[model samples]
Target chain A: MTLLITIFAAVICTVIWYKTAPKNEMKVGILCWMYWGASLMWFVDAIIEYAELGAEFFTPETADMINDSYLGLSVVALGLIIWLVILLVSDPKGVVRAALTNKK
Target chain B: MACFLIPAAEAVITTVAAKIIKAKEEKDNGNLSLTDIKTDDTPKLTFSRKLGWLNKLLWGGSALLAFEHIWHGEVVPYFPFLTAVQEGETAAMLAEMGSAGVLMAVLITTVWLGMLGVSYIIEKRPDKASDTAEETQ
Candidate 1:
């Protein structure tokens, strides 16, 4: 269920972003980050849950590898959050202007 | 699963058929004008407007649902069956939490649909007013 919802969200958001976004590179980049970051986070959580459900099927080596990389996902998530914050707060006027001008 | 897989399979077939048709057409016609294929439902975004409370309602609801699942089912189970886990002594707890998650999803979807309806109404209002003004003129 989570996988379905996340995939739907990712595809819809990507299409919406691509269709509606202005020609500005920086703004487009920020929006892409926001969409993909959210999708990535959701995907990871869904995968982890599904993995836990089928843990018996996994080899001990595979389980160990997953456990070792747990912190890496968190780090990436944190970085995305920080990037989102920067996009929201710093030089926000440009974003606001771009958004407003985009209304057709 | 059948409900899910059928549409996905249909989409794949449709896309492949469309590509084949387009390729055959291009081979026969030499060139096709892209502008003739433009869609009318393209999104028009206004930068001056923000989703405001509606955004909060939908996103906040999603966050709440996630929190509810984690806290009640995974972190701390207030009830063994409905809230904690899906089977055995905790089955009831799991069921309850699952119901809550479904409720949250419904609420979020309702709020979004309502917002879309409101936007449509609001956008229509200006056109109506303009029509009236033009009629008066």
Candidate 2:
């Protein structure tokens, strides 16, 4: 479930990024990359867990799904945090810079 | 908690960095006035700016999710992490969180695209006005 969420987010971000590739003012490419990276991580996790759980993997208890959801949200949050850091560092629009500099 | 803290910390750091950059710019050119710094003066929309909207959506969604987790007492302040949900609870969690997560993602994307549409119309208006003016002249 976690993997599915991340993959879905990645796809959405990617499609938007691709359509606006020429203008990319918001630097969504970074977000696309982040989601894709997370999707890949979750994919590997799912594969490993599936191998370990075998038949049991298909029948995840209610608690497991909830936990997975939490994990998925965590991953998504972490990716956003990383992207925020990148945006601040780059200051592409210079809003932060302008805000800090403007004495008025 | 970390989820919330991470973005907060980034905001602080970015502000500080902006201050430093501002200071440097001031020092390099004495005539550089604060009022002169117009961040929105980009004549055309750039790809990065469009992505910025998406970034904002992600931030908002993440913050909401973190708060929700905190409310549910699912947040833990330790390293190997929060209480492990029992096997029986997995199905319930999946049903609830799965739907919620999907809904949040869809809502964010929809809002973003809506904003984009509005911006396109707003951006084009000026051009249209200018074209009309030119025709009249």
CA RMSD, predictions in order:
16.0, 13.8
lDDT of 1 by residue, B1-137 (tens): 01112222333454465566556655554575221232243333231122322333333223323432453344333543232343443555445434433343344335446757776666545466667999999
B85 in model 2: Cα distance from truth in Å?
A: 25
For candidate 1, what is the lDDT? 0.42
State in Å the error of residue B11, model 1.
22
Task: Give the DockQ of candidate 2.
Answer: 0.04
lDDT of 1 at B105: 37
Worst 10 residues of 2 chain B by lDDT: B1-10
Q: What is the TM-score of each candidate against the true structure?
A: 0.30, 0.43
Once fitted onto the true fold, the runs of candidate 1 whose alpha carbons sit more than 4 angstroms away are A1-91, A94-104, B1-58, B64-83, B86-90, B127-137
Q: What is the interface RMSD of candidate 2, in Å?
A: 11.6
User: Where does model 1 sit among the CAPRI classes?
Assistant: incorrect
Scored by CA lDDT, what does every candidate get?
Answer: 0.42, 0.59
